[model samples]
Target chain A: MKQSLTQIHEMWERFPSVQKELQDVLFIIQDSLKANDKEVEKALLDMFRAGGKMLRPAFVIIIGQFYPGNASKLKHIAASIEMLHTATLVHDDIIDDSPERRHAPSIQSKFGKDIAAYAGDYLFAATFKTLAFHTDDMTVVRQSTKLLENILTGELTQRTNHYDRHMTLADYKEQIAGKTAALFVLSAQLGATNGDAPEEFVNLVTDFAYNVGMAFQILDDILDYQSTTKDLGKPTLQDVREGVYSAPLIIAMQNKPEIQKLLAKKESITNEEAIQLRDMVIASGAVDEATDLASEYTEKALDYLSQLPEGESKDTLVAISEALLERAN
Target chain B: MKQSLTQIHEMWERFPSVQKELQDVLFIIQDSLKANDKEVEKALLDMFRAGGKMLRPAFVIIIGQFYPGNASKLKHIAASIEMLHTATLVHDDIIDDSPERRHAPSIQSKFGKDIAAYAGDYLFAATFKTLAFHTDDMTVVRQSTKLLENILTGELTQRTNHYDRHMTLADYKEQIAGKTAALFVLSAQLGATNGDAPEEFVNLVTDFAYNVGMAFQILDDILDYQSTTKDLGKPTLQDVREGVYSAPLIIAMQNKPEIQKLLAKKESITNEEAIQLRDMVIASGAVDEATDLASEYTEKALDYLSQLPEGESKDTLVAISEALLERAN
Candidate 1:
């Protein structure tokens, strides 16, 4: 849990106001998950302490500042978003059988998959409890609940897409849009709608979040090929072994159709073959091509940010967006 | 899904009205789960079609008849209760890693654990979606969502309590109260509150549900000791293998202290040991003891039902309660 917090924490240090908001979010999550069973309670909190970028909550909190929203309510909503993200992560690790989450052994790996499933289920239920407790608006509850559906549908789609050497770049975009961006859009939308933000502004922030999420996910997919286990705080070639074709691999396969033979290994993918495939994708210059797409999405996100009225919140949003794009880990 | 339906259906034949209500619930569940991804949609439906007793929804529907609530709205809430119950069952199978459910291959066994997890998660989201879509009452949403918490908290507690040779009657009672009774209580409570039922009546129905659920779960555990795999539609003596000591075993252990040596095998318990444990439990007359306790609960449930003003619904509740208690499968 402590592994990447040092780096992610350092990034948050530059924006004390946003940092304070995120700190409150952490507390609300901790308080909300105070379970009757101490072990059940501790399982989720331990995962929370193994922090990530907190980017989703940051989006909710940062966008929350522009005619933003209710003070205490925004934090509750932000905590809800964070908790949903973590629950998906726990389930995702189980699905992928991935050993690490943010540089720590994943819940599924550290505990049994049964414990992992329960912990995730606990978080899923806690999320709704938090939202329903804090917000009377059925729209908030309904939309957030559907947000979970969208996320899982994306996952199911990707599972079908798995090991298909013909998987296209378009498929990747659609998959990630649902898989990753839906939550981001919801986070921004909830913060804006929570208070007095007008419809026009709510629409604008959702567009901004949509773009930011697209770029964020593309960057994440790229890092799988470019970053090390230490840098990513998870296995580097993990996706390849699991037969999940991300952007760089998809682009590389297109440019060099010969790579399909290696991908055709599917379940039989050997460790050495996985390493070879990684080297081949990097060698094919797909990393640079994928980065160009990420940059374009980043530019679009910045364009959305540029339209917001001038303020410290807007400036902080811009700084964070740029830092997120330029991040090494 | 079809394995035990013939038997369960024969029991339901006497109550055509409740059967009709359940049919509508099946349609609502089918309608709610129609998805963007056909496979994702089909996955849950297949599990749903794997017929269940639909007892939870029946509780909601029967209680709704007392106040005679909004027709369509009652169906939706009943659907939500059924979906929640099914979602938990899918997760339970995954946790137990059991080979069968209702005389059919479990979702985890049939679709692989990843798909099973997604299928279960999808149902959880759909359950909330059903509730939110049906009512604007945040109390309904809040309480039902917390009901999920109570159910999951019971599950988490069980994991900690697993394999404990020292498990007591008190521990078993407390565990089943949360695990089994909470949902039943919520089912009855939601239906009563859905209409104009007074606070006093709601208490009566919830108390009835609590006693019924306790008896129902105790009977289920008892069946694990006395019934054949074909009779139960699930593997017999499975809980003993999993170290889930229930009423029969707990009662039998008190009668036969020598059983402790066998239970002390714990994780290393062999197939023969599991069968031997079951035989010993049955031979010790603990099954009879467990049946006596279930009948006592059945009487308490009937007493609560008796307090309700005489009506066709009350009579139906009494009939179903007795039938459920006398059920052999």
Candidate 2:
């Protein structure tokens, strides 16, 4: 059964030790976004305040807690990861022409696409600046840089294959691996390395993160079809509208011949059409299948965690993954 | 007088040693841009072949030649700098809505703005990847990252003040310093430091590059008013049309009340109005003033070159700056 919001909040409350660290990460991000240009600064601040889950940073801190590490350095790496994620979102908003993000006007909608584009670039530069200035480990820095390259390559792949209804399940997996899993792996790897974890532990945590990220994204795509705009804080059926056929849609098309015909039209679907498509996807039980796949990945992640010694850090990591499985936003 | 294209070619011919290295840099760039997505690779390759002056890489190589450094490493750094530059151009073209670049269709024009935006981002990620993977010096990496931050800040400033006809000459100088001179400083500093030049030499070459960069941008802005589209490889009067009052326009508005009144309208200037504005800027002798400033900077750059040990590298540096002073494109 999906956890309720109260349950998710309770799980978060259990991680009070990292709350202060998370706040410090927020401060670092805010400082990085501050600029001499008031307009740019304001735009960035507003976007930051729109409030994300900051799951990547949370993962970093939680994983880092499993070993002895400088809390401050962990916060810096976490902040950098979050900034990079935000940068990608800024550009994604432009490409998707998204009007709202986190229940507020997106950067592109509020400040025009040009500013949105520059804001994304600014955040990217800030991410590197933070890493270069704060992180002492060149190996960590180099690995993070490689992850960014992979992330962008994934984005290019998605862009090139935009609206490719013929895209296979394997194609979807590859895209998400680069787009989503790479950062997750980076977050865990950085946390472990900084925490002075052994090499085997680092590898284990990285594998855990990859599974968790894959599940997380799969759940996210499922939510797009299941949740309301008010609940998700953004529009629904966006993936299909944008021609990005996610797991649910791809799975549904196999069983629902009508879906294939609908997707084959290659034109923008109307509100009625979108509703019909969503209903068909849900009715075809593809959402359940995708959710099951997500659960399987989440189970794999939990299995990896079970290999480590039992501790609060491990418990928090498990709880976070479980909450992600039930997360509505 | 501005030099002819033939003169620029002749100046380039003075540095045949770096030409082979430059080709290697190009190959690295091509390899970096290659992706599983053929369309993206092709677009990037087309942009590369459209041809740039490759002045930044040349600057890096020429400065590196002054000391003993790994040739391949120097080439990597040069390629990284050039890739960073090309990335900026891709974004700039989108922001400017430019149709042509280097006498060919721009990425935005050919592939659309979304793809253009991603291409720019891809290049930036590739740049950092190359630096992290190949360049062992963390200080150089940090400095380059900081330079990118400053460059983006400059871009934000320019965008915020897009058509501010009241922008002071000082403001213009500061903007160009961040937007243009910062990268030039990075190029020279990276080359000198990697070449294992002394601290004093690095500082001196960096300062020289700053002066040269300032002069180059000033001359570039002046040429937007003085040259034709055929000579420029893109539209002429683009700055004024886009409400980007460059050095000549800024200087002209200072002394000519009519020019100020004309510019204060704050709307996109029609071609006829652009021609009139160009004529007014020329008639007001602002072009001459801007030209004099460029020449002063070039002289200062040459003075710095003279202070360095007499060598072929020094001569090539001097030639590059002199060529820039009279360059039409």
Candidate 3:
């Protein structure tokens, strides 16, 4: 769908303030980080300039549009969520040994592991500091923090269970909720809190974000298996190389004895095995099944938007939910 | 300093409640972490049982004890600080490549790199969640978070500068202050804030803690070169092995030509090279100079205590400052 003028204006209005707040919080750490060595800062800044969709921050602002309070404070919260998302991506690259991110060299690839690790830490610290700017309500502080905690737990769970073919869809869902959906949920909740919405509205939006976030991740997982390398902007069968078994792969493993056998080995799968696994997943209709599941979650998210009092912000949220589904296909 | 029955009783009185608050926060994350994986929970609990000096929390409580107000609220603050400290240590082991921590296998060693990484993340989340329990004052949340952000920057600095011989004593001090002393200063400030002390007192105590914390770290670096392996509870030259050039080493390197040459290729320095560097550090009296600097900081810390109102808690702070110097000799 084409962007609405109102949506465009809202997006435009939000970006500069959020960016400024982000810069404000990050300045000290940005300056202090350089004190250790100049190379660290240069490499990190280069990596950070690589483009991101900033989907999480957009959601946060869309939610804030409903409440109409201190726009600057809400913008700080939005920037913080984005910073957190970015930090996780940097660290995830390290964990997955990913070289390319956002069509550019990952911090890990450019600066090596030690510098990448420091970059990730700096971003994480910057996120917390940005969030601290929204110090008016203890509840906001509490929830934002709890969101970070959940994200960490998800990361740990994924780490501990790496490469296990036995992981169920339930396990995948829980893990992704922590790792992927968590910031999404937090973004929506922060928006509601910024709006001074009722606690129930915040809860509903959080639930909506959670489901959509799960569907979003599942779609990504499916695309990882089904999409062309060019389309995905990365290698085919990347998750398997990183020892992460996603939902579609889990489903495909049920019937494909050969793929399962190949996956059980510690070494990288042969290119032939990777192709076979990919083809098997598409042929078995597991990708379709996961896509259908994602749609269900999207529908649930739309229902959440419908429940909110009618407004442009609410309508935009509904539109965004639909757009997110297109990400899967 | 002799043991005081009054101080011990006060600690006992405060410990259970503070622990309970920490447990509540950990329990939230544990529910999700331990839902499917029992190992994560079991390992974390084992670490908790290993028990730390809980110095950060104690500092929080001691400074807090001097002021008048609800003592109960201080529990969450102290617990949160301790949790942050725990999370930092968990990550530090990965960076330091230490095998053991607190007399047990480091989380990185016990659970492998992936889980260890997650465990650190979980603790980080838990720390923030604990902050959320403080529904009364958002300032507490904001200030505490600022402290955390500063500390993480410190860690990033240390990581980025690892094995660089060019780093000056000034650089070392800045890194240590951020990584180690920032939280110590925060602990005192948080304690003072909890007690509802005057801003001047809080500033004084924070300065005291900052100096004491720096002294503590400088002494630690000195002992790493001067003390036996068993006394330090790890290898004698562990920091140099990990590529961290401490203050004493920095000073020693400036004086010794051989040491300068040895340090130039120091990133891949072997065990023998590390010991040789350690000996050079000792022989140059740089260790003694570092110790003297630590003593000066310790004296300043005690001087701050003397300016504070007379109380048993104030006396304890003085004693702790003095004890920090003893760690060097």
All predictions: root-mean-square deviation over Cα? 2.9, 4.8, 5.7
Model 1 residue A35 CA deviation in Å: 1.9
What value does the lDDT take at residue A122 in candidate 3?
64
Q: What is the TM-score of each candidate against the true structure?
A: 0.96, 0.94, 0.85
- Reference-based lDDT, each prediction: 0.84, 0.82, 0.70
Docking class of 3: acceptable
Pairs in clash, predicted candidate 3: A67-A195, A149-B125
lDDT tens per residue, model 3, B135-195 = 2666666776677667766666676667787889899999889878888988888788776
Instruction: List model 1's recovered fraction of native interface contacts, to 2 decimals.
Output: 0.86
The parts of candidate 1 lying over 4 Å away from their true place are A1-8, A327-329, B1-8, B327-329
True contacts kept of each: 0.86, 0.71, 0.59
Tell me the DockQ of each model, to 2 decimals. Answer: 0.78, 0.63, 0.41
lDDT of 2 at A199: 85
Any idea what lDDT model 2 has? Answer: 0.82
Angstrom error of the Cα, residue A137, model 1: value is: 1.9
Winning model by TM-score: 1
The docking quality of candidate 1, as DockQ, is 0.78
The whole-model C-alpha lDDT of candidate 3 against the native structure comes to 0.70
Q: Residue A158 lDDT in model 1?
A: 84
Candidate 2 clashing pairs?
none
